[model samples]
Target: MSSVTSSSVSLPQGFIPVMLTPFLESGEVDYDGLKALTDLYLEAGAAGLFANCLSSEMYELSAEERLKVTKTVVAHTAGRVPVVATGTFGGPVVEQAQFVKRIYDTGVQAVIVITGLLAEEDDSDEIFIRRTKELISLTEDIPLGFYECPVPYKRLISSEVLAELLPSNRIIYHKDTCLDIEEVVRRIQVAEGYRFGLYDAYMVNAVASLNAGAAGLSCIQGNIYPELIVWICENYNNVERQEEVKLLQKFFVDSMDIVHSAYPIIAKYCLQKRGFPISTYTRREVGELTGNLQERADQLLEDVDRIQTELGIASVFRKTLEVPLK
Candidate 1:
């Protein structure tokens, strides 16, 4: 087991990509493909990696596969950047706590619990608080985080819950998808005295979030254009580049439909075009990429290429042929 203490560990504060799991045409986890994917994210200068996330098709993966995949990412990263994995979804609090312990054993910096898993749809704040507190108590010493996974149902936390939990210093990371700038600002204010980091997944409001003291971004857009995402985070505060950043943000908003309509399939296709050793096969029922979708992806790539050329960023796509991981 790793001797590093979880509480002392601080997650990197930049573009942490919610990675997609690679699958072979035969519908098996492609280890080599996964290694290459990890390398690609690192090469794009990702601050950290979020594995076994919704983008990774975690619901379809068996418990063993989730553990194996998380371990593989930790092994490949080799301490270059911290890795956080989704450790629990729907289960009894004890079972979920046990799962968190198992994931912690894999050497991840933090384990994320999907917010919807903590209580039933009609449960009150008191129930949610009790369950969360119990899970934290059960998984002592392991750093815990929360993801508002929109699947099943999106249970966004209330400010009252944040006020209750932040003081305990147990929840160190939160992937906020609320998309309300005012609410994000309010939460940041409420969390001022705590050590927790808030990462906004809503790209449309990412710059504003960072401006309002969000620690960083965790988004699927990073899966296709990690370098560009990193560039935004690195330059969002530059006075001279404020206009340019706003324009870039506008571009992202305008192009969201083209890139996100097909989701992981389109994301995989982007990777395939970028020379990763993976297929566009997804466990989700999203059908094959039709010609129209392919054309849209191509157009998006063209826009990306133009932006890269203008910004002097060497394209991450098809630029390197070797899959560095053996």
Candidate 2:
């Protein structure tokens, strides 16, 4: 196998925040906010950062905006840590590959792809088989991570089909948001020797996934409580570690209560509360999150601060999740 193929599936320990795109009153990308947020996460010990993604509202941004975000993030990060950007917009395969090429040229370390983006909702195994091959062909040589997000709007690739498509070492890892833990384990086990990994996006399943052989995690909860993630990764199965992980998990669930299911809205709100220059405003065309979600989100942050202080850890601590920050 090639070095990229044989390389360990494990990423550096801790949270890999899927960054939020701070916006202005006119709904333009807030460059200053983006820079400040990046600095804050790096200081708070995020394992890595992913830009132009679901959290960053890549689906709403134009291709030009996507490229701009990638450029700004890479430039600000310098060489401090690994950075990945979303590829495969809700567009044609070839057009998506063009977007991939554009960002790869910007020097991002990896590309995270959504398998298919079609008007009709269906995913034949052949789509992944052929599309991944085409992506590999077009990118020349950029590492790829499949974002196995739930596609309620479209067809989903089965775990069996995903396992079968692992021959392409370009698909090195997966950010699995599938709520089915058993299914994820079965799929990764099937692809054992192919250098694939699973990053648990659901905070509740994170410890279980790690115990089940996930190489790392890319959690949203990490945006607020990264130290717990780092501690779990560094000391899995230790007795003290169990207490810490349990506390962290409870903290995460409690935090979720404030937002309920308005995840993006709540996440951005918390980021702003942490002194990151993010606006609570989202594109109105995308629709608003119902309920007084932001109020609950604020309460969650207040609770987190109370917990962090009770534990005597700094409200936020720093660790290097990537190397050679520029």
Candidate 3:
């Protein structure tokens, strides 16, 4: 509510990366690196940014760090595009609502609710709906979204549950991790007239989801080769590019395991190799990048270049990153 606003018509489409938090070796948030990373995403053609997310290791960050991370992105963006952040950690509905308001005040267009953080795995949908309702009431009209974050536990909300919530006109975005195309379709079908969208995070069916009307993708793969993701989003349905699209889709399906191995570290490592000046440190305890994984990542980097060449697209980093560290 800082006078910053989203379309109210619909959320931004295409790549909305779940941002990674660059950290110093001493574990301090690297604001400078964060700024550079943000610019890289924009240069790569990201339609929006999802900061302070699970990819950003929201659980590991203190509330103060979360605010600062989000504020830095918002300030750096200076209204270039819509930005969203996870607003809920584990807490009561009221406390969660309070933090949502605080995050929205940081100038993000939407405050994302981590689904697992809202209810226990065994909790009834009725209980979950009630708490969500209470949160909506307490938070007023600030735009809200849902992330089926896997940390606490991924709570893939039912189409029934989503139907119940959309009438409020409060929920404007969804980061879907259901990994089910039919479920994604149901959510999009039900959101017909609302100012809301579902950005699919499961890349295995990225093109299928796009064809099914997903706003776009918000996935970890974007952390590694964001330009590739942007390329897919912009050309998912290009009939003439069907062959290239299928190949890219298969590449995503095959590379999923490796890309997820060392995670933000491997992602950062890959970025460093791409000539970006960002550290490979992570606060998530996702294990170190060992020799075997290192080789895989190195080979994967080569495959990325091949994909770029075959697709006739260039990595925006190559053009935007002016110098490489010796």
Best model number under TM-score? 3
TM-score of 3: 0.96
Q: Candidate 3 residues 1-326, lDDT tens each?
A: 66634335356889999999988877888888899889999999999999999889888899999999999999999989889998988788989999999999898988999888888999999989998999889987888999998888889988899999998888888999999999899999998988888999999989999999999999999988998999999999999999999999999999999998978899988888888877787888888899999999999989999999988887776636545432
TM-score of each: 0.95, 0.84, 0.96
Q: In candidate 3, what residue range of length 10 has the lowest lDDT sum?
A: 1-10
- After TM-score superposition, what is the CA distance of residue 18 in candidate 1 from its true location, in Å? 0.4
lDDT by residue (tens digit), candidate 1, 31-88: 7778878988888888989999999999989999999999999999999998999998
lDDT of 2 by residue, 190-270 (tens): 778765667778766777778888777777666555555665555556675577667766776656555435666666666
Worst 10 residues of 1 by lDDT: 317-326
The predicted structure with the larger lDDT, 1 or 2, is: 1
RMSD of each: 2.1, 5.2, 1.8
Report the number of backbone clashes for model 2.
7
lDDT, residue 272, model 1: 70
Full-model lDDT for every candidate: 0.85, 0.68, 0.89
- The lDDT of model 3 is 0.89
